[model samples]
Target: MKITPLALAITLICVLAVLAGTTAPAVASDAGGIVGGIFGALIGTVREGEARNDWQKVNREVKTCLSKRINVSIGQLVQKAIDPTDPRLRPYMQACEQQVAEANAQLQQERRIAGLRREQEEAAKEAAAVRNAHARAQKVARHRELIAKYGAKIASDIEARRVRIGMTKEATIAAIGKPNSREVVPPSNELWSYGTKRIAFTNGKVTYVGN
Candidate 1:
């Protein structure tokens, strides 16, 4: 009286197989087999979907219990499969806080050390600047003394970086800073090379200046 979906599907398959030139007995057997296999596959898929839904429901329940700090679900402690009970949250949090505090303290100490190093470097630079200033003041005093000793014309010539015959070795050095190389010739003569130029000195007095 009541034709189910499975019965209807089998009847349609049988009609199609018969129209396709299959014998009635062969069509009946092949249609039955095909319909049975399709139904079996559909049933298996439904059971798999139901099992997945049940797992998701259980997982949500476990998460809800943990969020509420219930610490247990379904009359049993449902936690991660690994390390189910070791290292509870409160102790773990305390340990984590201590580690954070220690890290902050170490960072502060390193900052202080870096600040001290910068201060030392600044102090060293200041000390070097002071020494350079004192040396410059001494040079000014010597230059003034030289101007008073030798006439202003000779002092001006030296200050203008000129090398002249009869100029003392000290005057020549003050005029042109220092020579690149110095060699002593035989019998107390000195030859000073300044890049492409050369100066010859005898008895501490300049005798010749030429390139």
Candidate 2:
């Protein structure tokens, strides 16, 4: 068979059309992959953002709950301390108040931790060492005074206060007068020492006391 120019041109056009049609789906598939990648990235970004927000919200709520508990404990300690009818129990009550103050101060320090976490989570590493040193120094001073003033009573009261660790410093002071001495716990900016008991304060609130 002899081919004419018109026939050749016609055959070329048909061949091109078939090739284009055959490859159309593959082209569409590649384009689809790009679009899917973009969509996936967007979804992941949204989910990560939401997770961060939820974490922060939960942390705040937990702190608030802890604060309320600390306050209630302090109030109870004050009530117990003021009841002169139980003179034997007064010392223990005073200790409880001090523990509460200490706890409140610790909580305040934790609030600082939270803030630091928000700014730079790594800050906790440095902050922890500083905090520990402060706690140790305060503990030493508190133990010395307790040994000097209350003697055996200090140990007994401390044990009792452990059972009731959420008293306020104000109530403790009201019950036992001013502290014989006071010292600051580092990093937390809380006070600690011994007079009649161990006490801790944070943001002017009593959070822990110990006999």
Candidate 3:
């Protein structure tokens, strides 16, 4: 229901076509010796406007039909403009129709080229995504292999030390070594801490030992 720019432009073309048809003879007669020139100019203006309108309409129709899975040709639309009933307008119509054909051809060719470029870009992105996924999978596999090689022994050592709490700091230090770091916990009758080395004793026992 809304009148789009294309529709407005088409209306303008139709108005101009009627004006050119009615005024060409008058303008030609008034020009006298320059009648041919005036008529030529009028024909050229009408043809140009018609060609422009045809091109825009063809473009819109092409998009609509393609979206709906219907096929139509630009050339056929141009041919319809060349009405045999209006013999006086034949020359102008022919010229405008030729321009429409040329414009449509150029538009179609450009679209083809654009489609190919988009396809290439999408293919590249897909290839990169596959490569990234493969790389991540390889990394996960390597991590799992390393865990299988060392995780169980580490787990066993940690579990063994878990039960050996209640030793003095000196005794814990003697059994383990110097801790990489230490922290004090306040208020809870217990200092809970762990580090990368030695052992930490809280309330006279080894609470944490790390290697």
Candidate 4:
């Protein structure tokens, strides 16, 4: 089977546990430490090439695992490191366990906050869509009323589907349905802006149209 990073990391922990539990000298992770130096020196005397190869493989696997499972494996290692049979591993185990608990709790809280933020954003989008639909319904109703009142000009224009120089506001509304927005600026010019085209009205009649 292909060796995974977690598998390698777990192997290292197991090795540490075995070494720590033995009657042999304590092993430190640090190379400069007496226990660590002794173990390294012993490996050099026995199948040095094979020992180095195995360590290199384990090291690579651990580095890969660290990228994705740093927090989780660290917590697991700390939890497993507290074996009472190993006096060397006992002192710091309680503190490590507490750190893991706190870290996990904080991570959970952050996820909760993120979930709430997402929910609020979705609700806001849904509310905006609802408001837009309601506005469109009201606009369609208003257009139908206008068409019922002044529909003859619309019918003529529909035959040609064209707006000439002097179409009335009601006829314009019928022909184009409704504009995106209406602007009555600077003495109320009564301009209607409809995506890439603007129509100007004077005395409720189209005076200019620009596209």
Per-model TM against the reference: 0.43, 0.21, 0.32, 0.37
Scored by TM-score, the top model is 1
Q: What lDDT is reached at residue 23 by model 2?
A: 74
Query: Each model's C-alpha lDDT?
Result: 0.71, 0.55, 0.54, 0.62
The local lDDT score (0 to 100) that residue 44 gets in candidate 2 is: 52
lDDT of 2 by residue, 1-211 (tens): 9974445545655555566567788765665565456555555555455544443443334334433644533224333332222465445445555666677789999999998778775667669888999999897877666557545454345534431234345434533556777777665546556655667776554667666
Clashing residue pairs in candidate 1 (N, C-alpha, C atoms within 3 angstroms): none
Off by over 4 Å in 2: 1-119, 159-211
Better of 2 and 4 by TM-score: 4
lDDT of 4 by residue, 85-138 (tens): 245533344445555667778999999999999999999999999999999998
Query: Where is the poorest 10-residue window by lDDT in model 1?
Result: 75-84
lDDT of 1 by residue, 1-211 (tens): 9975556656766665665555577766776677667766555555455544443554343335343564444223322221222355445434445656676789999999999999999999999999999999997987898799777777888878898998988889888989999999878899999999999999999999999
Cα-based lDDT at residue 104, candidate 3: 84
Model 2 lowest lDDT segment of ten: 77-86
